[model samples]
Target chain A: MRFFRQVWVVAAKDLRAEFRTKEAINASFAFALVILLMFSFAFDLPVETTREISGGLLWIVFAFAGTLVLNRSFARELPNDCLDALIAAPISGAALFLGKALANYVLVLAVELVSLPVFSIFNNVSVTAQFWELMLVLALGTWGLTVIGTIFSALTVNIRLREVMLPMLTYPILVPALMGAMQLTSALVAGKPIGADNEAWLKMLIGFDVVYTAVSLVLVETVLVG
Target chain B: MINKILYVLGIAALAILVWNIYTIARLPEETRQGEVFKIIFFHVPMAITAMICAAVSLVASVLFLLTRNFKFDALAVAVTEVGLAFLAGNLITGSIWGREIWGIWWAWDARLTSALVCWLLYAGYLMLRRAIEEPTQRATFAAVFSIFAFIDVPIVIFSIKWWRTQHPQPVFWAGGSFPPDWTTHFLWNMLAMALLGAVMMSVRLRQEEAQRELDSLRRMAHAL
Candidate 1:
């Protein structure tokens, strides 16, 4: 219980800080919005095709902008040397990682909330009917990303050109999980028959989330101490 | 003595290469798709040997992480170097073979795509090592990254395979059916390449040790 509290405290610290500045939320949201608008311009495809492709495009924007968000994730701690302070504290590295990831998920999910609606408007599709189902996919997908991204951000936090290194270090490993997200989103967008098919994808997302989170929690300590 | 073994391995691997060339070059007139099929022997061996390299690196990385031993890191660096080289050869040869059979330079076949992902993962691993300067920390990070990357391999294969079945069908199968003699050739070539890969790993490990020794000597002289 105390361990969970410690994790929540770490996340609360981030959320409190982020709520004050809204730096990650505002930047990532705008970046995703612009990318969505650009795709709207460059594509010029018909509405049916646009709707079909929009799922992928939506995730791509989120992904590209996510690099920026995750880059600054640890950076927010660096100006005040908060990261080092956190490392010095008696907090479990895994708990710290989970807390940070939780904060990031909240922030990225906020970004998604802002832009996904705009994406629907620009592409002339209504997500209202499938919004809850879509959100479930988004939540699972974002969970996977945040858990992995937090660890990688820590890995590259002290390195030179880490902003670049973070993405290169991140995206390859994220592919399998991201692939799950893309497929499920596609099915949701296309309004396909979804009982077994989407279930499998959801299962994959859960599996990836379970597997990576478990392993990364164990490994995060090594990256954190340094 | 080890150097002599490496020499034998290198020579034997080369001999297999020559024998492969001879067999393909001397195929009978009525043989179907005669010379084009030759690429498979090299392609399969390189891919399998590349996998061996990756597996070795993963194990070494794990050992380094647990033991915090620089020696394991050295072996890891050697294996990664050799593995990445073999993987590059595999990708190129596999693509050419794909071209021969599928008439395109690339196809998003599950196996090929996962191999590409594996290559990217290792490439990133090397880059991660270069970016971190501290000796012990670098090894730790590299080891953790290798483990993370290896865990991803199965997920990649699974996700991509599932995606293939869930999505549109495009005849993504790229390799042609193989003959019995070709399988024999493949096994021999793979054995030879694996032997050479092991040799390269040991040689690189020795070089790493030498360089570390030299580095320590330089530090001592500087201290003086």
Candidate 2:
């Protein structure tokens, strides 16, 4: 109960602050939109090639923009020494990590809500089939993203060139999530029914989500104190 | 005494490796692999070398985390740097082999993809060390991040391999079959690579100690 409260307190604080500035939300949306616009001209291929890779392009945009959200998540904490103040409080380190990750997840998902529709429109790929499953994939993918993003963001908080460093560190480990989500998204775009055939990839996403989240919970405290 | 023994072994290993090259040259080559097949002898041994170094670094990182000993941190850093060299060797040879065999400069095959990712993880780990200025705090972060980065190895392998098979493509990714004798021949080269890694790591550790000495001396000079 107290743990939950601690988590909520951090999340609530971040959310209240984010609600005021909405900085991450705006930047993430704009980034995704720019990528969508580029997708039209960047690929010299015809419609079929573009269609095949559209899901991948969207996820790439989201992944790239999510970095902005993560960098600012801690970057903002630096100015007023907000992270030190939070640590100085009695809140557990795990709670603080969860709160930050959850806040980033929400920000990524909010960007996704707008980007998905825009992606569908831009690419002319109808996603009416397996809409619910697509959402599930989005949730899991974004969760996986935030889990690593939060931990690495914290790990890199004091580093020089953190903005460049975060994506280099993250995109590598994002293999499972990126692979699983791209596969599922391509299928969803193709209007294939989501069924047991996709079990392994789905399990891949869940397995990574579980392992990364658990490890982050344990290590986030270690990363914070330094 | 240990350093002397390591140097002797390293020199002896180099001699044996020079001899192994003769045997490798005499052995008949595969039709498809042709001359590029020779790259595997270098490729496989160095790949093993990098893996061994990464494992050693991971152990040292854990020791640092447990004991908070700077020595373990130094060992970890040395091993990781040596590992990076071998990893770079592995990537270069693998890509060269890929272009010759796969007709492409790169392939999305599991082994290649995982190795690339593994390289990134450790590169990021090293950058992480540079990010923190305080020695103790940098050690703590490195220890934690090493563990985190190491965990990605198996998962990257598993996921990329599965992702490859699940969705079949036109890519020429069928594994190359080396003769059974090749595995036996790999032992000498593997030993040589390990010896090479050890020599480099020893040199790195010596440099680290010298730097530590310099840092303490500077502090002492300041105090006076």
Q: Name the candidate that leads on TM-score.
A: 1
Please list the C-alpha lDDT of all candidates, in the order they appear.
Answer: 0.80, 0.81
Fnat across every predicted model, in order? 0.65, 0.68
RMSD of 2: 3.4
The candidate that wins on lDDT is: 2
Best-matching candidate per DockQ: 1
Candidate 2 lDDT = 0.81
Model 1: CA > 4 A from native: A197-200, B27-34, B155-181
Candidate 1, A1-226: lDDT as tens digits? 9889999999999999989998887888888988988998998888788767766887788788777777777888998788899998998998898898888888888888888889889888776656678888899888888888888998888887788898898888887678778877877887764477567768878998999899989989888884
TM-score per prediction, in order, is: 0.92, 0.91
Q: Write the per-residue lDDT of candidate 1 for residues B1-224, one digit (tens) a residue.
A: 88898888788877877787787666543265556666666776786688777788889988888888789999988998898899899889867766766778887655666778888999999899889877778888889899888875564345445655321232214553455555666677777788878878888999999987898898899999
